[model samples]
Target: MSARSLRQVTLLTVVLLLGASLGLALSLRVWPVSCPEAEPYQLGRTGRCVWAAWAADAYVVDGDLEQARERVSALGAQAADTVCSLAVGDCATCRGGQAEAGADLAAALGLACPDGVEGAP
Candidate 1:
């Protein structure tokens, strides 16, 4: 191939590679991003509630019911207050997390959550 043509191809390949890399990076970030909506246990926000719920679930899985209850109760108390402050995306995420945790905790405690709250996979 002519040198001019080769240079053009190389540039295009580099551009495409960089674009792909950037897209991959962004996609990865979207999936496993850290909680950024609230301070842990300090604010009465959905994020805090969700985090507490998750903590409760983990505690329950580890066979600690008292700790799990404490976590869920605290989160539940705060959830209503913080729900309004969260953005739509954050609110949905927080609510989902809380529900999942609550369900897991309930299951661990042998309580029937007949409402069928979803749990995280």
Candidate 2:
């Protein structure tokens, strides 16, 4: 093969590999690939955290401290559990994000978080 043709082929190969890697990374972010057993728990925790945060924020904005506090406490509990089961590395990052979401919920609710929670964001 000509030198230019070989260079073109190499470039194409590199592009394809990069595209594949990017796709894989994006897919992993949206879909849970490992820990099938933990998938349900993760999804439940995520949903609960999100809802709690929204509710707490609304209550806080409305000056309903009591309701906000209740929501925050519930969120903190969910965050603690979700953070605890996450492994190191990328799993840890995902779990940490969940924990942060929970913390945000608690903050909005004006509630003090409990101690000894794993991966407190």
RMSD of each: 12.4, 12.8
Candidate 1: clashing pairs of residues: none
Candidate 1 C-alpha lDDT tens digits along 75-111? 6654322322221223444433443344445555444
What candidate 1 gets wrong by more than 4 Å, as runs, is 1-49, 78-102, 109-114, 118-121
Model 2 misplaced regions, further than 4 Å: 37-40, 43-121
Whole-structure CA lDDT of model 1: 0.50
Clashes of 2: 0
TM agreement with the true structure for every prediction: 0.33, 0.36
Model 2 lDDT tens row, 16-121: 9999999999886666544333332244322322344445557666888687767656667754333333211113324336454444444444343455433333
Shift of residue 69 alpha carbon in model 1, Å: 0.6
